[model samples]
Target: MLRAAFLASTLVFSVVPVTAPPPVDSAVDCDYYCDDRDPSLPLSARRSPHRPGTSTPPAPAAVVCNRYCDARDPALAPSNRLAQTVVVAGRQVSLRFDDTDAMGWGAIAGAVQPGDEVWLDRSFDAGVSWGAGSRLGDTAVPPGFGDWRTMMFNVDDWAGLGVGLLRACGRPAGSSTIACTSWYRTTWNAWDRRTAAATALMQRYNLSTGLFDTTGWWNSANALNAVIDNIRLTGMTGYRYAIARTYDLNRSAWQGDFINDYNDDVAWWGLTWLAAYDLTGDSRYLATAKAGADHIFRFWDSVCGGGIWWSSSKNYKNAIANSLYVQLNAALHNRILGDTVYLQRALAGWTWFLNSRMINSSGLVNDGLTSTCANNNRTPWSYNQGVPLAALVELHRATGDPSLLTKARALADASTTSAFLNPGGILFDDGGGGDVPSFKGIYVRGLAALNRALPDRPYTSYLRRQADTAHARDRSSADSYDQPWAGPFQRSDAARQHSAVDLMNAAG
Candidate 1:
């Protein structure tokens, strides 16, 4: 009977754009915590050898690019109409059709410069499209650094460096150059130099060790680097060790410095490692990913029904974390485990999203849950939208489920068509107002990944057009690629408060 029910639920849906209104409350039960519900049964313990002749899995889903570019069906050719570039990090960077349409948060980041300004605007209005770029004061800064000196520091800041490196890749577009002194970077270029150093730094400080660091074990950048080193040295320890640190281990040490504690952070770093593993085919990294996946499955709570909570705490469940995990799991599914079950779990989680979190008044995903959902919070985040759309594309491939693909298309359309985005195509910062170029980069990567996963889809052309725009803007401009210059404004009060380190790292 269970088999029949499962088979009946397996329906291949075509790409359907949902125009219905969002549901107030929808409950879906896939034994969300089945891994935890049966404590005595471990993930490894529950495994059964693959059953032959079950069925080939579904294809990956498709997503849109930077908000303006839509996924074109392969049957139909997509038109390539590009837009002007915006000035970010003190240079003119192409912004595709609109601001957010090119590369998002990443658009704001370029090769590190000596005196580049990292702006932070607190009263940013989401509705007001244009205004003076607010200069966020640097009230609080990490210790040891006297001021924001790009050259003086012994260790390069990961956040800033990551963005700079990504730009070098011409990832917002695509490039043959590795280190972009100008518009394009060579494949053999030094883009990985800072990345390796940043990874080493995080590990050296023992910050990346066991999932949790209650005692501030890996708190500082230096300390965290040590922990990362240990993991890299030893073979990737399986899921238990990784999860213990990320979930409970880190949660044990709480200081309220950041709203998100170690758990939230692990989600970010874990994915980072996973990406490295994907690129390198390192077995140890895969082992660590499995451990992280186990922890999430065991402790995952349906606080908002459709998503997992930020932490064990009852804080609002976020879309980004869950979405990140889904993508990680999907990528690691075939490599980590023996068969399609791992893919099944990823599908179940995504299905939950379609039923729960991805709904607004218009039935579209209204970004993520607002702090106001249960507590005071804001609704809508570009990252939330961009990341999930990318993940859905992956899910579409894993299960070949048309419904997943349909949902992804709808969200992609919403992201571009939504009024919240600037006319220039930049995502409204914090869903308020402001043009943060970094998100544009992020969107580009997400869209690109989706296009890659779904080769049959005609979305790549739309994405390529956006990439070309980013390329043309930074063309042959050595000044744009030069590292930032240092000045009083470099260490100004505004930069520190915004935690420039965190944002900069993601872009790279």
Candidate 2:
């Protein structure tokens, strides 16, 4: 289905047989040294290039969440969301999403405690990885310039009411709430933009019957992510309109004649509902995620020697669909205890994807396998690389196998290089038009998940460079973020903005 520019036929997707892994020290020098032979040594210890006695260094300053926001763009104004309060330990902490003057993450902005550190162990990843509490308000910027609380506020406000929602530009804070230009419409933010845009795309373009639109499912999933992310951060309420918009209520399944027939699109929404269930403690969302997982596994066959098909037509097997399969299983495994089936599915899918020759010699993941089961030689999309990176990391956590972690680290390291990034670490892949722009955000999200898992790794610093560059160079005075992070602002859309938001949050 993907008609990218470089699609080419290759020999049957030849199996890269699993020979005994070359000795850990001499495995062609991937991201870090591939050392999994020893079980007890921490991954950092195993990959250490320094002397045996060298101390494990502190995390780089650039990577971890510092201050929430600052005068980095003196232009940023306070646009707080519907304020909400939550009980932390026992005391209630009032939090806002868009406070230009907020102090810490959840506590009332400006509420700083001596030696205070935020404990970040979130389900942002399918599994729970703790960051061991980093210093709150840890940026080099001047005090009060920014705080952890308002970090995502400015971005979401701009995307929703600032630009995408209210279509207001250069207006002062709170102007978004009022009808300024004789035209008034309901406004949305990160809390609701994905659902709005995706539904619009679906209504505007879906030819398929019953379903909102095949393409809308992607943003539908994104909207679901936005809602989950909002509740996770600001302690506000959750919105399920995105789910209602894309979901087929009559059939009660995401993929059907009324919705996505493509397995991956269906899987995307299923994963979203899973995140919602994880956050909202709703069994309905979990049930939807499980059904989606079952549907994804149904597509898995021995046809290409075991990988999920891209569509029900069963003509092609792709990296995107398969990688998503891995991710869904990984997340399900994280949510479900005493269930080895999800882990089993994750292991099989990952194993097939890894050896399927789609990942070429440079460690870049190719697009899909041709009808003959050969590497299709399609231009590597960002999602292909990103989804599997987190999936593999999740798998490593599930099995306690360092080999999976080593491979995930390799993917993370290689992704930051020319395979995906341009100079200054701005992520660059295909052009910004069409769906290509959305792909990078998925990759960046994967990077964030990996960062949460390995807080001390350099991945966080590199991703920070991406977020900072995006804020500094990608956007224009109009507040619309452009393509190529550092280049031409041509063709900005929900995709680019969403990726930008993901990157900044990752930095935090």
Candidate 3:
């Protein structure tokens, strides 16, 4: 059971009655608003914010309609709808929120277009919402310095982003070689990493069983799952997928030679596989998730006066990892149907995070330990704060713990207002020197996840607005992928195209 924090004992593991979706009424149907009262509007239209007008404004630049447009919009339609189809490895996936809910893929429906106007900000909120298509008018950066790369090589994290975009958008109902190839290659890369790391860890550490070879370190099962799924999707053979078990303390390089259950890698991989099982109904993925869950359970002792250790190392007890542990366990308990033991583990881990790591009054979650254990204690990052909010919400759903909900809401409030997010809710990474996208991406992801978990009218609307603002700024930048310091902003048509896809995906 979750240890009582600020909430009184009355709010034990009892479940709260979820507020039903509001009845649909004749309101300004934000292209994607949800109202149970009126299910007549398309779910996507309901979730969408009310656009200023139905007709899209003219594109700032002209892009070739290409094969995707030829296939999807027969007339080579230059409408915003055609722009909604983002290219992936020379293929484009159309964005239509006809079936999905606000929680699923509503954020990015607007940005994926026939042309690259809107850009997707992956970190801020998955691709449910969009960023700017390309800078609006003169605000747009011209192609130069960063322009050559954009022109010469359209290379981006194209494959991964494509798969993610496709998954969120409707998977191509038909098999497009372009979509398949992009999906295949991306999954292959992820698989390669996971396999290499897992193999190396098991061999080096002789990790036969238990939570991990050492408790203080991290785990890689979840990472492995992400990789494996990619591999399966792409159908790549002999990919030499490598996964590592630990990070070298001196070199700071992730060592792939041994298994350690301390890291929350298991949770991520297991969850991924669990998702795969749901999507594909594969028994192997389910089995793998179960094994990983069992390993996680081994470490769930009443340690450090609360949750499990960050890793096997007694010195490494930290909040970020433990909070992840809470989320992992809770996901398994709530989403996946195995390992009931994780329920108690999730409860305890959440309680410790709330009582110890969470910043009282501020509702911010902190990283328990860092380079300097004493001073670095409780210094929070978006990921640290964000993941816990997600966990708290999930736990609240599973256990009806009002405190968890309150804490999650509080954390969400703090994150939206913190330095991590620009005033408009674009997530920015702090202490990253200034790798804006990567930094903000994680933050945005956390917010997006929270938005999905907690479906309130006010909160959902805010998420939509924030999603729009981030995309607009992102499109204004010279290079979508490169940070300001990434060797002078390089702009490419591919980059612009990607930006549009990213933005539309985020809006969904």
Candidate 4:
């Protein structure tokens, strides 16, 4: 076998480097651990077993770019529309438009210079009625521009840099270029509204006990996630007070009775507190996380060989609770309270999860393990795929294993397919009501974390498209949004609104 492999080493393959189109998340490879990626690199598919050859197999298909231009006049042909050349990043780029009926519908994005002009030919109604408007100078930021540097921590209704967004001006006031500046990010976020929506939801749904009655009842995990988001977005003392108040009501986590009575639900609350501690530096949050982690671990035993039960009763083992364990323990090891025990348990738990065969074919994850220790043929929920996908990413960071990224990439790729995403790459899942409507947002949030670890334009573009769709289609007259991201308002609630906030916030 060794001699046969030696003969296959003579094959030659051409190497061509390509720059990634969108900005990579600096936390992943760009800033600290720069795992520079060149899209032109060929896939690792084997060539041949018999002999070395001069010919090379074709490179994997390039990422497909969806072409869409919103024009006021559908009657005007694309060829007839004037194409203007603008210098963006020192290269003269053409602003092209096609004949289409979409208005405030399609989005285009790119970097821009100070003198660059981005104009839209708008028609309010029929294709025959057309009017034009152009933005100028540094003030020419696209509607919904995402440059946080200029107005950091300040209030502005300028949405965020999502789709169809052009660049903001350069620093020190002149010569603006979007070439390689982290300050000039192109994002698809609706922080102003999304954040506002979340706050409103909290106010409307929150009980005096600090748990939210999001829809009809209080869901422990859902409320925990909301509290974390509230802290993350606002960092206000009021939200922290509520968090403390909630613990006062449900103080049995340390005594092993957890908030919601389910191990997975309790794990979520624990994970949220871990994040809360990360943000606030309060030892109380850390202590709570530690206590809950202990409670969750108590469920682990020889049952189903190795895994945590869905609840303390030990009736069934599942993906979410175990995945959260992996993430929570690994985070504890990395962050403030340095504990290797959590790390050791994290590794062991992740192994059991993988060996359990919960991750199904098509590169997606199933719901949980069956009573017989096999993967339950349950429908793939977005959160199920999301939590595990995020856990894998954390494991990759902890271990520095490249294959972990390969596994994550497979799941990410599968997530963007028809099962979880729409044709425009908008996050899509069965909005079958209850907690189901809120699932896609969790998946999107996880994907955003993945992007920060490993930057990819397709992933960013997918997010931007969804945000644009939401901006154009999802919002109601009163600024409330519906469950399905692809349309007009159907029904509105805290869970769905919170989910929207998650998606739009991650757009940045």
Instruction: Write down the TM-score for model 2.
Output: 0.58
**Candidate 3 weakest lDDT stretch, 10 residues:** 146-155
- Residue-by-residue lDDT tens digits, candidate 3, 1-508: 0110111111111121222223323232122211121243344322111111222222111211212210122122222111133344332333222111111111122223222221211111111212221111111112331110011001112222211111112111122222210000111122333232222122112112211111111222322332333345444323222222211211121222222333454555555556556545656656656666666566655544555544444445566567767776776677655546768878877766655634645556555643333224444655566667667766776788777777677778877677534433444443421111222333444455666666572355555554455333332111122221112223212212222222233334
Where is model 1 poorest over a 10-residue stretch in terms of lDDT? 1-10
lDDT for model 1: 0.35
Between candidates 2 and 3, the one scoring higher on TM-score is: 2
> Positional deviation of 335 in candidate 3, in angstroms?
3.7
Question: For candidate 2, lDDT tens digit of each residue in 268-340?
Answer: 7777777767775878777777877887777888987999987666667889889989988888888888989
Each model's lDDT comes to: 0.35, 0.50, 0.36, 0.50
Which 10 consecutive positions of candidate 2 have the poorest summed lDDT? 1-10
Q: What is the lDDT of residue 364 in candidate 4?
A: 72
**Per-residue lDDT tens digits of candidate 4, residues 289-313?**
7777877788889978898877644
Error of 1 at 183 (Å): 15
lDDT of model 3, residue 380: 60
Instruction: Kindly report which residue stretches of model 1 are placed more than 4 angstroms away from their true locations once superposed.
Output: 1-264, 302-306, 339-341, 361-364, 370-377, 426-438, 455-508
Residues 211-251, candidate 1: write the lDDT tens digits. Answer: 21111221221123222333343332221133223333333
